[model samples]
Target chain A: MSTKTTRTQDILDRTPSSIALYRLLVPFVIVGLWELLSRWIGPRVLPGPVHTFSALYEGIQSGWVIPNTNVTMQAVVISFLIATVIGGVTGLILGFNKPAYDIVEPFFLSFYSVPKITMYPIFLFIFGVGLNTKVGFATFSSFFPMLIITMGAVRSIDDVYINVGKSLQVSRYQMFRHIVLPYILVQLVVALRLTFNSAFLAVILVELFAARSGLGLVLQHAMGTFNSEEILIVVTVLAVIAFVINIIFYGAQQLLEERWNMTSDEQMGI
Target chain B: MSLTGLSSLPYSKQIRLGRATLLVAILATLELVGRAEWFDQLTYVPLSTMVETAYGLLVSGELTDDIITTIGLVFVSFVSATLVALVIGWFLWRHDKVKQVLDPYLIVLYAMPIFVFYPMFIIVFGLNVFPIVLIAFAMSVTIIIISTANGLAKVPDVLIDVGRSMGLSRREQFRHVIFPAAVPYIFTGLKLGFVYAFIGVIASEFILSNSGLGYQISWYYQQFQTADMYAVLLIVITLAVVVNLGLIRIEDRLHRRT
Candidate 1:
């Protein structure tokens, strides 16, 4: 049995690293093949990696990319922050109080199902074709998922934990701070990741629809002018930024989950 | 602990009543403020006017045609995306090396806003439904791949071993065990894919198309026809809600079967 278990463990250990290396290799090969094909096909049909890289570098060096990217990121950050605070507070209220949940939960479900991009024109009319419109959409987009996740997280906490706090003569505030907060912290991280994802989509959608300045604007202009190189550069940068953000958030989630698991295990004497 | 209400009504009924009251209150407030012209500078048309205009638009063939076009685009894109994702996901499941190598790319693709590729798509496919479909497909494919792959990865080793012990062919085992287990995950992917595809289709319409609800909304915006724009917006929102509820029902049915 011990030997069998060891063999299984060995297989598991070997699989992940080999998989990682292969994952790394696939992109390089694809990029290389793409470069070769582009070179063979000519710039009109396809621009080579070198040309695209140069264009991207030039755009960055000339400060053409920075301003738009900055504006987009600003909208994303501000909207995400606002969504987080509002969603968190509302979620807590609903989760903790049955009356509030009963009153507001159905409304959230109905609105959450709606495709927000459909409302872009209304938002444009209300806030005009500006940063506020973009940010408003982003906030709206991020709010629902965060609110839902928070409610779920809060609701999932064992009643025993709350009872324990009460038994210890903990004040309502103390109960929330000591037990409720920590219980929801891990879930909050999950909600934050989701909120960020939604916010990113919201920003992109809004920018694509009507934006005077942003990466979307840059792409729109490039398309209009047939500036393939510039478009590729902007796209590559956005992809990289998105990739980095996802990786960071994923890592953070894993770390938080591990810590929470450890603490919970200790409490349970497991 | 206090789940049993003092009132004669069941807890669910009370909850429903509370929800209904809140909805009514919100709608009333919105109607009052809208009709009162509290935000006249912001919107020239009130909510009531917007609804009337929306009803008129619904009667017109314009709204129907746009809805049909958008739905067609969404359906086509979703089907293609799901097919592509299934093939890719299966390939990754079979080959450890390929799966590893493609994981980062997949992650990057998943995170990256594929909407940015609209220009490239247009350059390749032009300003037609083809480009819109491609955009929607790109938007949805990543979610499908992720969910499908995750689903496959989550299959129990014991189940595989049991199948092997039972002398089941690999293909048979995959069809019967792996596929069934992955249904829920695939449905999850489908749900997300549909939502994204809906958004992508609308976004594409907004960016380039001369027709469709998105185009209509944009046209109304350009004309400063606030009531018409709001009407279009309401229609879009209502359609989305209906589609979402439909998907949810499908998901629930599938879950029950599994």
Candidate 2:
């Protein structure tokens, strides 16, 4: 009580180590509280952080991570590719064709607003509860953003660039390769990053709904059996994977943008 | 003047007509194909069948109840998440150190499949609306926080100086200068946060719970009632469109007022 510190003074006095200490302090408090609560409630009702972490480690050691993670990754990657390709081409067509865009743009806007997972049952019925359905779900869920972003990118390319191509009397293919492709590539990369996240979530959702194997399946089984430790472990692993993938995409996007000498702010009129 | 009228009025009319025609064309084609049995049972269902099933569900009041449940969850979660985000965002703006340390983690939170935390939330809150609300809140709060902080930061130093020169206190300056300046960004955050909350609740209902439109979807799909499932899906899409359009109108009004 005698050694009271002012808020401004405390803030000004914070060094790097103190800042780090403060950062750790929140989680430490949270975990401490969790552990205490868990003890009071017992492990069956609520496992402590230590129990959950150890179980996660044991899960990794027991070869539970590989097959399920591989399945998820496969679905995510493949669906991302499909969404990008289809969405990109469709975006190009709509971006160029004003009439076509007018006809379809409103529908796409509505579709984008809706939770796309509602369409999953349709995909499930069509593709069955297999790789096809999962991939289809991932593709459907992820593609709209890609489509919208790509169309924006295409439409936003300065008229000057196309004028130069026209002045040189270049073929359509040549104009696209020389002018449009480079201009839109950076935007495509941004779209890819977003699509990856959506596709990954879609895979998890589909797996949770109906799947024989995957991280979503793991979570589903755990929740069903009331295996909180297993559920926590799988959830942690999925979060880490998502984090790592996002970092990689962010780094690559930055590098690509730098090489292209374009900032997203300048390009993203949309 | 005629050209202007044509471009402003008839042009928009033409576009709307074209959109309607395209929709009708697609629906008619699907109806034809469905009736003809040109595709497999899983692949095609007639528009008439879907409409009939939707009407049946509506008449029975089952669809209305489910819609109310889902929308109720979404609204509660969205509002709470926005409130929490505003408080945290204001605090973060007050403390630079915490903001800097937590920046990357917030990005991680937004990027990841936060629904994975649903199980843990379920354990904490038990198997009811609480877990679903928590799931929506977790998914959306980060987005609102980032946007709110960005908005607050965007309040110009010159504006604050002006407020001070006008003999305004700190709180008065914030209220008059900073808060108004940040309204656009805050609005954006609220809009996006609501979307995330909607998606989170629906997805959670699909996976975790048993009494919303999402649950109906899962239940119908499981029971092989494809037409009813499609009807529910259609209702959801319509709701999204209507809600979004309503929000757009409100946003426009807000912009005009500001």
Candidate 3:
């Protein structure tokens, strides 16, 4: 059995580079196919890879990447911060008090599915066509997921932790700080990751609907002029930003998990 | 101790009372604020006015037409996306090599705001319902694929072994054990798919379409018809609430079976 396992391990070690190559092969094949299709259908219908890259390169050189990206990120960061503080506090209150949760949970759940963009007009009407409406909408869109997750995280804490705190005669603040906060910290980070994604999406959405600046507005303009390659560039830039956010949050989540000595899934009771 | 003792009271009745009270309080506060003109006239609309406007629109069958269009887009896109996602998810699950190679891209796609592809979609499908439906499909299909494939991956080898040891054939093992295990995850995917599909459709309407609830809201806002905008929003909120509640019910039933 030991010899058999060693043989398999040796084979696995030998194949790591091959696996990496195989991974690259998939994207290579996909791009090749896309390029072929674009050629066949004509660039008017679907721009080839070369055209997409050129547009993306031009977008960067012309400073299109910097300003629009900054606008979207500003909205995301501002809204994320506001939503986190508000949603976190609200969640803590509701989670700590079952009566409050019971009173409010139905409303939260019901409105959870309400697409935030549907309320953009009301926001636009009130705040006008600029950053305030965009940020407000972004905050509103991202708020509920964080609220729900934080509440769930708090509620899912094993009751034994609270009982231990009570038996040790810790003050309520001390109990919450040492026990409850530590327990829910990982989930809170996870919630921030989710909120970040939603916030950016919301920001882009508002920009698409009624913004003078941002990537979404650029995409809208591109669409208006039938600039498919430029549109693709904008989409690619947004995807890269999202990927960076994911990496940053994931790293933070890992750090928090290590410090807190708990995984989010375990805290979630999954 | 007192709190624990109070918990023994009829839980359902207590919960219902709490919800009702909270709803009433919220509505009353909004009405009061609107009546007192707390905010500027341009900023706030009372719930009564919103309802009245909604009723007017309903009687005229305008909002209903938009609702029907939105629902049709959602329904078609959702069904088609689910089918495609299931096939792709199954294929990915079957091919471990492809799964490993593609997982990171899928994760990026999941986080990426695929709605930004509207321009590209419009380029491809033109100015019609197809772009809206495709946007929704693009948003949802990735989620379905991930959930379904992840579910398949998570089926315990021990359970599979049990099936095999019971003299079950490969196909039978998959049918009885693996498929049942994955059903819950598939439902989760479906629920998320519905949400993204709903958002995508509404958002597309706002950006591109001339009809649908989203367009009505935009149109009314453009016209400076605040009451009409709020009325359309009320209908949207109602639809959201009903769909959410319905999904929850279906989820609960599925979870019970598992």
Candidate 4:
């Protein structure tokens, strides 16, 4: 019975059309409810979706929104890149060397455990309130998860793999490139997703806290001026952008994991 | 040093000892640099002064109140996030097609910087605990959903079959089999959710509010009262560490019970 069902539904199982439809319907239902509620509550307290969408459109067209978004994206992208390179290198070094891990692991743990925003003011004073300062803060906040996850991934490699490489007379460089590098790549993908998320949060925090131009700055201005329409538009755009990025990265992670698992299975003759 | 002598110490203990020594050495170096005027140009108070100020802040009622508010907000948000995640997660679990449809949406929602939504929250909820709590909830809810879904998905099929064989209702099977199996995953999600919620509350307060530890830190920093700023920062860090450790302990205990 199970085999027959599996065979019969193989094609249907592969297609997620129903799921996609449900997803679309759910959001519409939610938005419809929100629109109804907001209309009932009135514009001053809760603006309807139509008003919010129009406000967002107008705000963007007026050039009030784009500069801020560009500035914020610039900071986020730069910091994210810096964090990835620095964290990847540091993680590789620590993961490969047991003594170094013992020496530096504690500091990383302590710092990671601390609420990073608490140190923002100090960063502000040092770096000043500009693009560099926001980027610096974002980088610092994002580096930890990448470093830790990468280190853990590297450390978890089987001793048997190392022994096998040794038996094969693999050169140090070859061992690193073939065995260590590929092993860490899977973990790195996961780390990248997390790091990107952290970087976004960090950049947003810095921009909101003190920025002359950025999406955060615009949101702050809207809040201060009590411009609910503008605020709604900016936030909705940011949320939509963030959501899209997350979905892309999640798909990448899934693909990487599948590929990695397949490669491992083939290598093990499983 | 003889390899034999080193081998006498357990590997875990050796690692712990080495880590502690490294931390102490780093702290000592910081103290020395702080004591010497070598980096006087650096905008930082000496370690001793910061510690002293931190102690003072700990004794103050204002700082205490701020800490309490932050913690209260985290707890409220975390509970709501957990409940929401559980409901959504269960729905997804019971219906695979729904899970597939919503997976993309959830991932996107998870990735988005929730801080961006603060303005909307402020407009809707006002510049009070509600906005802060909402921020925390928003930050945490995604984690709960992801973790809960993962947990439920990982439940062994055999267990579900056994529950069914015992004449358990769908709800009973969920409560008796699915929930217990999913608890660890849920707790893992809770741990991450709690951390994000804590940070979210503080961050919201920092950006918009006039009260809370984050606000106090910002206020002190703006006033150029470095000591007071450091003091508040220390209290905030201590609270975060304590809360994280407490959560970890709870997770461990739950894991053991399961």
Candidate 5:
């Protein structure tokens, strides 16, 4: 078995470079396909990748992209932070309190599916413009998943460790720091990837509905003017930004798992 | 420990009662606030009033049209997305090199705010149900594809070996062994897919649409008919919660089975 494993590892080690080549080639192939399809589909409706990239370049050079992206990202980040902190605490409480978890979890699960965008008007009325509404809306969008996972993380911690800590007369703080924190932190990172997506989606959505400024507004204008290239540019930039954030969160989760010596929630089937 | 003997009830019964009581308390608080007019009429409509308005709307067949239209759009897009995604995902699982190449793109699509392209969809497909369907499809298909692909990847090699030793064909192997094993994961994807689809479609309507439940709510809001809007939202939310609960139940059942 060891000999077979070593042989397989050797084969795996040799293949990554080739896989990297394919990964790099993917965007080029996609761009090429887009360009070809544009010719047949008509440039007005579906501009080539070259044109879209140039427009994106112009937007960046002229200062439209940066400020808009800043405004949108500010809302997303602020909401995400608020959701994470509050949701984590709430989830910990719920996890340790079974009656509360049982009662609240169903509502959380049900609310997860509701198109929260429908309630934007209520936020608009309550906050009356500025940052709070977007942040609140985004927090609402992202909070449930974080809370759910955190609760599960707390619940899933092995009883053996807790019992050992108690038997050792470890202080509550020490018990948390030594056992609960590491396990929960890893799971928190995993949940953040999801919550981040939700937060960003909510922020952009509100911007789309009615915003004084943001990338969503830019996309809306492009739509209003029927400028396909501009629309594609904003979308591509947004996708790239989201992808970067997602990759960062994923990397962070992996680092935490390795460095903290934590078991990932998935391996426990939670 | 209770003098009234209340604590003698089963633990499960206590939980159910607690859940029901909590739910009622929340609704009752909202109802009380609405009646006392402590909150602005613009923000809080009495739950009773909202229900009454909804009944009137249904009697006039106004809400029925919008509900049917929105649900129809969701069903159509969700079904197409599921079929196409399953095909593409199954093909990718069969082709390792292609899956490797496409994996990052799928991740990006899944993470990105696909709803931002709702306008582009509208432009391409025209301002109609087509755009709505396409937006929902775009929102859902990537996650399904990714989940389906991951599920197939996790199908135990031992199961395949069992099927092979039985002289099962490739199709039979997939049908009897691989598909069943991967079902729980696929259900997870489907639950999220349905969620994204519902969000995408309704949100698209909220942004721009002439017909649908979302349109009705937005229209009322725009017209300053806050009570009417609240009523419609109440109906939509109830429908959403009930349907999603059903999906969650099914998902739990599947998880247990697997």
Candidate 6:
């Protein structure tokens, strides 16, 4: 669940254990360079880590951080949930019917590849309010990735299981429960990781564009005042939040995979 | 589509027809809704009107500079990011210890909100094209690096051995064996890199820049030219879909090769 291990486990774990020392040391090196750079650029424009952290602490103590962060988090969470449910169900249903999947697959791919930024304005007109646009953009952005991943996973369920279920004349519910659901259950968490990341970033993006109150507003205020330390503080806070969310989902994915005795490699027919 | 739908056509043609029909259905509904005055004149824009607005802008040569700027930035950012990523990727591939140290950081970098530094970029580089390019490059480069490293790593051991057995030098082995073997993976990276770079450039323009395709769209919306906004939005959407479909075509070709 640590940041280091949140990447594909095999790739992250393949390095020699001794390399772990470098992993631990790299952050220090980056911080050192950052400090020097900040000094060169002038601390007012680019604050050092020490100053950033101190400002973060002060910002927290001043109590503005909580309300703003709360607003962003609420929007992100709601959008994430909405996207997951609708996208997952749609993916599952379409994924099961090959004909439907083939027709829709191109649509999904187009949606996934098209940057939602271009579509944001249209939504802005349709929704008309900043908050509606924010949540709508986040949800809309997250939906395709969730659907695509879920659909792909569903489509990859081994034919053997379905064949056996067919032979046994299992009910659709039973077949889904004993076969299709099991495979996707593990992948669902993995898909959620992507969806959550997308949702969080999308929310932040809209907040940056037009939000009454959010961490992005905090960031905008800092930029307005040329408060470099506060900008760093908010950036750091966001990074930590994103990092922690990734780790949590990753841990859940690992746990689910172990319980299912199925890694993505197996699901992928690799 | 079901067998009942477009059953007379070949399968691929049937799919195309089905998609066309679906698209027409959706667009027709929108056109009807727009004509019905459903969302007030200020909000909804019909499809035909959007096309007319786009034609008007094109004929008048309006948005020409903005279109050029957006396209130029996308091209520059993608190419630069690709070049930088390939070099870094090679360095990482050759240096196991360095790769180990950078792997997690790479993931973090790819996922982190690079826009957090957008404020600094603007202040440091000023409100020029440089900041936008830098942000787009940052947005795209990490995925390319990771993909390049992955490709190089996946180069089959047998291929390398074959190169060595043929008395090829280390450099020759990389050039002939590793690079060719890694083309598919690298191409995959480039594809994703381009997508990210395009998005990053447009998104940055939308958020800050005073001029560009993204800016024009937002400007139209803000000025209450809802039809003009949709028209420009139509342009952006069409560009996106065309480029994406083109990439997917090439990607499919690459996959077929591999």
**What is the C-alpha DockQ of each candidate?**
0.45, 0.47, 0.52, 0.48, 0.55, 0.46
Best candidate according to DockQ: 5
Q: Residue B182 in candidate 5 has what lDDT?
A: 93
Clashing pairs in 6: none
Ranking by DockQ: 5, 3, 4, 2, 6, 1
| Residue A26 miss distance in model 2 (angstroms) | 9.4
lDDT of 6 by residue, B6-117 (tens): 5877888877776787788978997998898878777887888989999999889898999999999999999999999999999998886688667757765776778767
lDDT computed for candidate 1: 0.76
Candidate 2 segments exceeding 4 Å error = A1-42, A164-186, A254-261, A265-270, B1-14, B39-44, B156-165, B249-258
Give the TM-scores of the predictions, in the order they appear: 0.86, 0.84, 0.88, 0.88, 0.92, 0.92
- CAPRI-style quality class for the chain A–B interface of candidate 1: acceptable
Residue range with the least summed lDDT across 10 consecutive positions in model 2 chain B? B1-10
How is the predicted docking of candidate 2 categorized under the CAPRI scheme? acceptable
lDDT of 6 by residue, A1-270 (tens): 122243345343654666767777877898899899989998877888888888788888999777788999999999999999998999898888876788778777765656686677667777765777788899999998789888988888888989999999999999988888887787777688778888988887787776788988877776677776777887888888987787566557656655555555221111
Residue B133 miss distance in model 2 (angstroms): 0.8
Q: Itemize residue pairs with steric clashes in candidate 3.
A: none
Best candidate (score: lDDT): 5
Error of 6 at A97 (Å): 1.3
Candidate 3 Cα outliers beyond 4 Å, as residue runs? A1-34, A170-178, A251-262, A265-270, B1-8, B39-43, B156-162
Docking class of 6: acceptable
Please report, as a value between 0 and 1, the fraction of native contacts recovered by candidate 2: 0.61
Listed per model in order, the count of residue pairs whose N, CA or C atoms clash below 3 Å is 3, 0, 0, 1, 0, 0
Write one digit per residue (lDDT tens) for candidate 1, span A1-270: 112232233334543465555655765787799798777766775687788888788888899888889998999999999999999888987898866675676567557756677676667666788888899889988999889878867777889998899899999899989999888776677678778877987887777667988987887787888877877887777877877887676556545555454121110000
- lDDT pick, better of 1 and 2: 2
* Ranked candidates, highest TM-score first: 5, 6, 4, 3, 1, 2
Fnat values, one per model, are 0.56, 0.61, 0.65, 0.60, 0.69, 0.40
> Could you list the CA RMSD of all candidates, in the order they appear?
5.1, 6.2, 4.5, 4.6, 3.4, 3.4
Write candidate 3's Cα lDDT for B5-103 as tens digits.
Answer: 557668777777767777899889867877887666667788888889899999998777898999999999889999999989888888876776576
